[model samples]
Target: MSDQVVPAVINLDVPGPVISRHLYGHFAEHLGRCIYGGFYVGEDSEIPNEGGIRLDVVEALRALDIPNLRWPGGCFADEYHWMDGIGPKQDRPSMVNTHWGNVEENNHFGTHEFMALCELLGAEPYISGNVGSGTVREMSDWVEYLTRDGDSPMVRLRKQNGREEPWKIRFWGLGNEAWGCGGNMSAQQYAAEARRFGTYCRDHGGNKLYRIAAGANSADYAWTETLMKQLGELGCAYRPQPFMQALSFHYYTIPGTWQDKGDATVFDTDDYYRTLAKAAYVDELITGHANVMDCYDPGKHVGLVLDEWGTWWNVEPGTNPGFLYQQNTLRDALVASLHFDIFHRHADRLVMANIAQTVNVLQAMILTDPDTKALVLTPTYHVFEMNKGHQDAASLRVDLPAGVPARETLATVSLSASRKDGKVLVSLSNLDAGAPADVELDLRGGALSGVRARILTAGNLQDHNTPGAPDTIAPRAHDQVTATANGLRVHLPAHSFITVEGRLG
Candidate 1:
């Protein structure tokens, strides 16, 4: 293993824009209990719910200020025909959810219910269109039903179904997992179909519809390159015909081996470091994919939307493996912080990101068990809430002393600083999970008085939260600080993430 040397002076004078709401976007799939018991639990259930939605889950998400939510499926979206999910719940058609457990989907939580949930969370809805098993007309009609304000057939159907006013849904996924669940088409085939579907996905002049084409799996730069070139050529020929606003990418970090993914919270130190390294791939993926986009369109017409991302591992023992119900731990929090830092640094190219599922699913923010107090906040959830300062805040440049921490693995350190009100908030995370890092801050021109720190770490690398011991590893205030003459010299713990806030006097 060889170590790559990086520059010590990282003078980031270029102030980047605050991250978008969709950066913290979440996913709601028809997979297993993610929908049935995870989010919607019929109104008749004894549990407290509003219109079948778990009230506790809603409240937890609200606490995190969940920005946007993607619905319907991972593979489920591609095969999903929107019509089956609309109309009166009783009259709505039933379909076999072949992609997830082969269970019968009783078309109860359809367009209206989803939009209602989004309204409840105050999150923007990002809907994935069916491009694999459904027709182009199906995709168009769904869009019309959601965005159209006129008296079209879909709009009339909307009125007949109850929702008279059109919901403001702007993000539209062209397809999902096209290489696999989404028809498993070659790049050329998916590109052609994407164009056809995107053409019919009209703006309706309501809200600016950001049409996102399904991107490649991890390291599949060819998929990105081909799509960008094809889309760019089409745009050149037809000024703005069926334009793409973003390209969606999906990546999950699993340790040990791909076949046998280790538990999220029961991993060794090596697995812990490896997991962080795997999560850091987002930076490389963003850069490589962006380079491809730059080749076709230097102006960056299409944004890189990390629609599906987070840690994935074997399901908790004794639980249904298909449910994807796993523990959330301090390791997850570190992963979240590291990825959030990467997204902020690349805010120019990276527009939106969703951490897999929101609640009761893979890498969820909140988990529940019929309101009997099984709700546990994963470490990932805490990092999101902690880093909200970077939301829509300007990105700052910070210089650090560079030294090799581990052999073979690539290492880098940087901090994104944002000023809100009269306080300067800085989020710092070390990508290296195996080695501790020493950093010196060069805040000469800036004021850094009255600085305090809050850190989220644990005694062991595999420490996690359980329903029995929920608050065992939550973040706590670590306000010990020393204001040096030159700048602040902080010792960062290995595999830990910290956020420091200072009021500029």
Candidate 2:
């Protein structure tokens, strides 16, 4: 393995937008075991639970300081009828989850259950409304039921269902993938529907909704262009449009073709590099959409939300093909670190991003065994935990000197820095599978001391944790980092992710 010294700079004085805590958000759709066996087991089951929500799962996610969670979709939101999921468990109507595995949905874990889960985790709730098959009035009434108080019909219905006070909710999605599973509508057609549906989803009592319009598929600049043009026609310079506050789109990293996404735990060197390259492409996608948004809304009033993103791979053998269950490895952790670094750089326009799922689905943070009911915290979980310090922190500019080794797939190393609460946190990832990187960080504009570091790596790129060996790929204190005269020096191993924290002097 080669150890080449790489030079970089971190300017503490040149700070950018406060990296939103919501950018580290997560998603929970009613697909696969994500809801039933994953987050919610029956209250009577053997697993430790509080009101049918798994306690172990809640405790594990709480460590990440989870900011918000998007619920009931990817494609399931459009087809879901909110009314069918309310009231007592036995009385609730069951429906076929057509988008997922064609499994029967009992509708037991509905609006109240979700809000309770959010409260247990101390996270904000981001609800995605139905617009494909449901009517405008139905969407409006549902919003009132959750947020409105006093003598309204919907509020009275909520009381009948045993909720006395309205729960405060801010983020609301207009729909899921409007171009495909959400409705199969053209961009122009969906834009008109967004205006009508958003008109009725009014602010109730003191709760104001941040309505986010369903945006383009990956790289669909024309779709974003159309939506922005329509929004421009609706408002003037003095007053911003009231219809929607932000726009959202989805992106996922796949190393191969869609039909044959490569295996998650078993892949060759080519597959490994290709995956990092594809993950790096998200930077371009963000810039392209931002360019279209700047044309009409140059003042940057509207926000860009990457609601659904993560790695997608073929399901494991013997598992149901429709479940979308896949293993997480060191490669997956590197991919997540790469994405977060890119997200920090574009904090000006990108307000939020949620991984495709939180548990037991695509690129999940934790995996559960159905029969044993055990939990395995994946490597990706450690990345989130280590980088949590960057949440709401002022982003610091990181610069790389010339002649650093680079490849067509991805750079040899990736980095990001942010300052918060009198501390500076720098995250670095060595993407090269066979080479080590020795980095000398030139901390400019300020002084720093008391450097401490932690690293997450494994014996092999395909190394992952199972229930029996949960700590196979966890984070450990790194003693290789040393304080320098100017700043600090770090030695990153092959295929590893590290975070350095210090007190700003």
What's the lDDT for residue 23 in model 1? 80
Residue 82 CA error for candidate 2 (Å)?
Answer: 0.7
Error of 2 at 483 (Å): 1.8
Model 1 lDDT at residue 364: 87
* Candidate 2 vs. true structure, TM-score: 0.98
lDDT of 1 by residue, 1-505 (tens): 2322322232234455656656878899988678888789888977788899888888888877888899887899987888888877889889988766678889899888898889888888889988888888888888888888978898998999888888888889999989988998999999899888888888886567889999999889999987877665633332224557778888888765777889866667667777877877788988998887776666665689999998898888877666677778777877888788778777777889988888778888888764464677878888887787667766666554445354346453546676656667777765555555655666644566788888777776678777788877777887544566655666567666788887666
Model 1, position 324: C-alpha lDDT score: 78
- Give the alpha carbon lDDT tens digit for every residue of 313-413 in model 2: 99988888888999999999999999999999999899999998999999899999997899999999999999999999999989997677677747879
Candidate 1, TM-score vs. the true structure? Answer: 0.92
TM-score of each: 0.92, 0.98
